[model samples]
Target: MKYFALLFALFFINFKQKTDKLIGRYSYLIEDNNSYIQKDKITFKDSVFVFDNKYMPKGKISYGNAILLENFINTSLVITIPKNQIEKDTIEFYMHDKNSSSANYLDEVTGKGRLIKIK
Candidate 1:
């Protein structure tokens, strides 16, 4: 019984650690200005992040991208963009929700939309 309890606790801890790996890929929409509208996609693959900003129907229009860095502190994911990429668009990392199976990504540049995981 004692060993079974220990094993159960360890299993839960390991599961949480695995879930934390999805941190940066999750995002949502936050509009300080109600001037624009639309949705977007934020994805993680091959150690790179793709931010598709084809949501907004106006303005110059652009796409955002970023690279993921291993989190040094806490279980959160750390994200950064290259200088060239930053010159064209803005990007950032968002933390994942504990209760969510998947998370939504916020556009750090336009701050207009979110990237939801496809089922």
Candidate 2:
């Protein structure tokens, strides 16, 4: 039992290191914003996801976790990005609405969101 426990502990540590490992700073952009903005920064450090828009009123910080899934990354209540959509410096969020695929995040006015990493 001791040997089994030790082996299992080691395996868990290794797996945790590999999973939830996206660390960097990314910024979200809305439509017509076309280009990247330094404000509204979203940072991911060791699986911790944080969003801070300097322009927003104080005490309005948005935070979550960098949940790395096999095919998607869920960082928001109703949004998730396909693993492949995450590029060298860009992360694209697509909306999956109900009545179509039992999905969420879709609407008439908005369909997708983009995040550009901060160098």
lDDT of each model, Cα atoms only? 0.38, 0.51
Model 2 agreement with the true structure over 30-100: per-residue lDDT tens digits: 44456534436766655345567544322222223422312123223244465555444777664443334
**In angstroms, how far off is 22's CA in candidate 1?**
4.3
Clashing pairs in 2: 96-104
Candidate 1 residue runs with Cα over 4 Å from true position: 16-36, 52-119
Q: What is the lDDT of candidate 2?
A: 0.51
lDDT value, residue 64 of candidate 2: 38
- Which RMSD does model 1 reach against the true structure? 15.2
Question: Which lDDT value does model 1 have at 23?
Answer: 24
Q: 33-65 in candidate 1: lDDT tens per residue?
A: 653233354555533444455542221111235
